[model samples]
Target: MTVKSKKYHISGERLEELQQIAEENMFMHASQLNDWRGKLNIFVKGEGVWVEDAKGKKYLDSLGGLWYKAAGYGRKEIADAVYNQMTQIESSPSGSATISQIELAGKIANLYPEKSSRSFFVSGGAEAVETAVKMAKKFSILNGKPGAYKVLSRRYSYHGGTAMAVSLGGAKTADPMGPTMPGAIHVTNWNSYRLPYSGDPVDVAIKCANEFEEVIKHQGPDTVAAIIAEPVSAAFGIQIPPQEYWQRLREIADKYDVLLIADEVITGFGRLGEYFGPMNWGVQPDITTVAKALTSGYAPLGAAIATKKVADAFTGGPEETFTHLITFGGHPSACAAALANLEIFEKEDLVGNSKKMGNYLFEKLLELKKYDIVGDVRGGLGLLAAVEFVADKKEKVAFPASAKLAQKLPKFLFDRNIVTFRAGDIISICPPLSITKNEIDYLVDAIEDSIIHLKKDLNT
Candidate 1:
């Protein structure tokens, strides 16, 4: 399977056109528009775990294109699937369903924690989350609890960029220009690296889980529609909560008759070595939001799968109709792409490989903690892992924002032709699930070299 090995560079007038038209005029996501307005890396090619810039320089994609692309890059099967579906039906009307949509929805429902489930599709992670919250509230209304509209999520969780999703993000990312949607509340989550409450890691996890119950009571249980959280919180860091924490959440939701929503935007589709993350916790959330790796970024797609108990409430009569609709939701081409991606997951055993390589990566990351700049390593499931930097390893004190350690470290890695995502002082090491052992070796070795140089530069 030979890919286009020839070097690709935009050196002539085309480069000028791209820069003048796209780079200068268009803004990037989650980036400072003014600061990076003209200076941007233009990637035009990808193969396996590597991507090539317009300059034809290749770099290891350590974060898998924002934690999607689970099947790696340049998958012809996925491309063919999308193309074939486009020829058949590019899209169906919002009120209508297509063959690909029906098949993919059925696939998702079975892959969810609840076998007897239904899937509602959307275009992105944020939209998927928004759909879940709306469904929760509507289900509450049908279930005779109209006041159950408030959504409770964890602090530092990144649901998405939409209004309701931003509110669920808590103080970390709520939009300042707008008021957070009414009734969206965020509670403390378990960050073992830096315990918000006073206790050991496992104990802190349980306490943090209990805080949801406390907050629900404080906010009035009847007013709280659902408790939404990630099975493994990844915005701040890859913080995997203990089973005790998950158990408590299940208990709390049941006790209060509140719905549980698992935001699997990052953890789903073999990222955590599980086909489904919430199921790995032995808990069945009433609603689970999924995106990112859903179609491996081959196309825009997301879905919220609801358990039968919750889905049954929508009798489709009178006020039971789901009024909201996304124009591109369940587009047949996107569904086709997802179907092909999942086939790759099973055929190549990428999920199994994720666990295998994930273990190997964790072992290597543990070795990195010997360095003063490497404060903590977090990960145990799949290809998800994070390394936190600290000025004082003994005290676990993160470098102040003024240090700009996060900003500087990536530049060092870019020089070494490696790309990984970072959140403040924490570096995320999630690559494509199809990543090889040799690739992991290269990634960790570069990470080590970068750290050694960063430490020396900081000292002076």
Candidate 2:
């Protein structure tokens, strides 16, 4: 369980060159720190749970390439699958009637809870969200509720980065952009730590469901078309709702006749110890959008799976077309990659691993709460968890935005050879489900050491 620092054998000059390349050419995400540019350690290779930087520094990949490398890095089978598919039918687009695309679509459709649901493939998560919104609206119209165009999303949940997805996202950071898509209504999310209601777990769940009903009634249910939610609330620190939330939410959606869209972009395909997050919560969605682990990020592929009821509403003669299409919607190579990825998940018993490892990680993280700087440690029984840092232990005071403490904490770990990041004030650990217990111990040690070091420096 111990991780000794390996010899970083590269010359200092070579390390400087890599740092300069990132500074000069890379366009970082909005969450990335500009000052940390020079501190960036360029990765050169990966195998299993370890990534080696250009400097030959080996780090445990706890973030798993934005939570996509579910099967772990340097998986030879994945590479072979992609290579074989590329050699066979590399360039067929969704626009054409191709066999690879057709077969892959069938494979994806089969993954849905409702076997009758159809799938519309796309390049990535954002595109999937965009397609889901479009489908929800179109389905609403076809069902004779043309005015129902609003999408209700939960606050602090992240959908994706596309305009429509960003609009659908209810996070604080997502709003700075002047104008997002209209009619994207947001309701309070079910994080008990932030909920206004003070009661038992079942009471809180009921209250949250009531809040959704209030939002619907206030907005007029006739005007609302769908309610999109991340079943496990993956982005906002992986907020796991209480037991009855899903059932109650489903009740609310059905009562209002609103299409329930589960955005499983981050929680599907073994991330939540289930095939889909919606299924994990025991609720059925009218439409489901998935990405991330769909192809384990080996290829860019996403799907919007529509339930039979939703599909049947549009199942007329040939004249009733979807009228929606992405040029590379069902790209042959992407489909091949996804099919292979699913096969790997099934063979590896990864879902079982996620459940066991998630429980182990959670138990370990609970020990972290003893540290004064760690305000909260939370997650579920899967390969997802987060530790939130705070300025004051007793008051739970968040570090000021000007200080940007959350960003600094992860960078500190990164510099110390642990790859991870944060969502808002919470630093998350969503390593590939294939990570071993020994790797988990290394990740925990890295964070533990970094926090002690950072706290000492801040006090001084």
Evaluated with lDDT, which candidate comes out highest? 1
**lDDT (10s digit) by residue, model 2, range 146-186:** 89988888778898888888888887876477887789888
Query: Residue by residue across 1-460, what tens digits does model 1's lDDT show?
Result: 2244465656557766787787657867776666455556788889999998776788999899998989999999999999999898788765678888889988887666567899999998999999999999999888888899899998888899887888898545444756887998878878878788887777888888888899889989889899999999888689888777888899999999899999999888988888877656788788988988989999999998888998888877878988878888877899999999988988999989988999999999899988978889988788999989998888988898888886788888888889765544888888999999899999999888888888887882
What's the CA RMSD for each of the models?
Answer: 2.1, 3.0
TM-scores, in order shown?
0.96, 0.91
Clashes of each: 0, 0
Task: Provide the clash count, candidate 1.
Answer: 0
TM-score of 1: 0.96
- Candidate 1 lDDT at 328 equals 85
Residue pairs clashing in model 2 are none
Worst 10 residues of 2 by lDDT: 1-10
